[model samples]
Target: MNSVFTEDTKTGDIIIQFPAASKLFKEYKIDFCCGGNRPIGEVIKSQQLEDKDLIKVLNIMYEQMQTTEEIDWMTMPLTDLVNHIIHHYHAKTRDLLEELSAFVSKVYRVHGERDSHLKEVYTQFFLLKDELEQHLLGEEQRIFPKVMEYDLNNSLETLEEARAEINILEKEHEGAGDILKKIRQATNDYELPMDACNTYRLTYLKLEELESLTFDHIHLENNVLFRRL
Candidate 1:
């Protein structure tokens, strides 16, 4: 059994192979979602991270994860996968977005004049929140049903619809990823200023949490579920 993940490995494929790999990728600030189709080496080179032992660490993490009892979405039934995406990612993310919206607004309103980036962060977040809310709804109402139906009956017609919907959703994922990145940049990776209050701190922290969750959400759909479809 080869336990090594080299630079040649596809970023998305790694997440499909080991969902837990997203944690390592997130920790390294490496993208394994929208750019998941690219090789790990491309990002490492572009980011000037060639000196880091990313491949070695990734291989080690993969080897370790093998010993743990984790749900392998790659081989799971499509219905099970869809349900997990809804329950695990969708429901929780909706709550998180709702929970953060007020704070995002407050932070921008109170501090926008003091720091221009706060305005950018505010604008980007609302854009993300709106886009994601619609995205989740689309998945639950449109594509996911087709996937579930195809899984149950293996209907060619349903499969065709699911494929088309998945393509559209993928493009939306790319756009959402771009907005999230812009927000991260505007917030300076969610660094709080010296005079920051509790609301400001909480806003930044939650926003960062949202970013992490969104990345994992996109990874599961793009790398794992969509491939199965």
Candidate 2:
């Protein structure tokens, strides 16, 4: 066992404490979202990965993460944090879903004949995109506003309503996460084929980016924002 990384460390806690660990987890095809609570040693054992190799990578990642820009969102004012989420994650995800849908369709029309799995990827992406669209709409139109109101004036009525909405949103988050997991599985963790076209390659890259962003988005909501209420 490497001294730099402990076996008892939770995968999600690793990523939460060191954002750079996310890249390492993705490289290892570790499910750091739904299965994030597992100990690193357990995950490594399940995935049949070498502990020494993972520890080496994590030590390097820890060093890099120290140099990266860190934001203390927990310290931010509630209103500012909410605004940032709306503008950064919600708006960005909406645009990405649109662009990804078009790109996935084109790739499926062209390269999917040769790679039957592309069809499955496209199907999963469609489901994910639709789910996200509705999820974002609910947050923007209903849930977020209520959260803001509850933050401003902590009334029992508003608190109960927000809690109920958060419960629903958390379930929706899980559903969206499941769809992304399916897409990732079908695409072999978004690895491009040797004969992949430019568009095919771009589609996979974009999908990976989308997954990373969504994970961060959900983490902020579930761990940070909702916990405050």
Candidate 3:
């Protein structure tokens, strides 16, 4: 709020000034801690972030003056919240994967001969994308709907059924978290080479975004969704 850092300021500028903002960014797995020197616009574009939604959230934060009080993340229905995450975060992940896939392929084709690391990173990105896509589908088709069903039902039979489902979902969450960590590590914590081309830079940015989305995704399920169960 009150422009923690000016619109022109890079993420690095105000991260130190606004500990709350920095914490929120870190919770979302954003690179404000490490890549804070980059401009917000550049960072957002690299991460394939939905500018409109991000801006809306920022406006809400500005109005609230603190991240904790900005949005009642717990108040929303599980189904509605799941839908929002899918539409905003998961869909963006799909798009970023596609973009990254193409970007990596092109970069590898053109620069892989000179930079062997590109090939390795490209392979890792592809593997990570496929795993993440499968994970998203599982949540949408099975885990989310069942969780919502349980939340809506008050009967003893429903409660028993939901408990069983919740156990399976929690295991899936653990597995997903492991894969996400692998993805992060495979990208070398999303470090870009000094000679990185635009495509390489963009690819790292998307990886960072993916990490953030996964963090939020897991937090919602582990903290919010499971609490309801």
Candidate 4:
């Protein structure tokens, strides 16, 4: 069927042009990052997803983008956004993960008998922590550097390579998302049990914060930075 949204329009282009589309893509579990170059209509058809609902969400979000309180990363320079990811999200995540690691460990040790989910939470968090540390290192050492190079010189080859690395990074993001989901499920959406101690409460709160920050971090990179290429 012929749609108002052109078949050839790249999903990345759509999201980059309308940041709010990221939320819709997320709601639909569309891989806008790894498959960013694919045509939007093709993605929908290939996934057997209904295009009408997707188009409706995209339209609503595009309108909201005009007046949303969110930062319009589309207008911001790639380098500046990269710096924000590094200093604002990456660095903060590193520190938070470290503290959470110790906190979760202590809480599990102290309270695991009362609530068995703490053990799972403790295990999943460390997995996420390790994965995130490596993910951050990869971005800093390789991905971000290549992006900076492409930004400076506009090398098509470098851009292609960066896009490939971004696909891998997006898979990593999915893995991290799974771990966060497990934690949330185990903890009942970070809800404190009737007997949850101070440390237990703090651990759950911190995990929720980590989830929120990570979502924002992934959104900015996947939606804004990568689309420019």
Candidate with maximal TM-score: 1
Tens digits of per-residue lDDT for model 1, 151-225? 999999999999998889999999999998999888878888999999999988888888898899898899888
lDDT of 4 at 228: 66
Model 3, runs deviating above 4 Å: 1-69, 167-172
Model 2 earns a TM-score of 0.83
Off by over 4 Å in 2: 1-9, 53-69
State the displacement of the C-alpha of residue 140, model 1, in Å, after optimal TM-score superposition: 1.1
Mark the regions of model 1 whose C-alpha exceeds 4 Å error after superposition.
1-3
Backbone clash total, candidate 2 = 0
Per-candidate local distance difference test: 0.87, 0.81, 0.64, 0.79
Across 80-159, the per-residue lDDT of candidate 2 in tens digits comes to: 78899999999999989999988999999998888999989988899898899999999888778777787688777987
Q: Clashing residue pairs in candidate 2, if any?
A: none
What are the per-model C-alpha RMSD values against the true structure? 1.5, 3.0, 10.3, 5.1
Worst 10 residues of 3 by lDDT: 12-21
Among these predictions, the greatest lDDT belongs to 1
Model 3 global lDDT (CA atoms, 0 to 1): 0.64
Show the lowest summed lDDT stretch of 10 residues, model 4. Answer: 1-10
What TM-score goes with each of the models? 0.95, 0.83, 0.64, 0.73
Report the candidate with higher TM-score, 1 versus 3.
1
Candidate 1: clashing residue pairs, number: 0
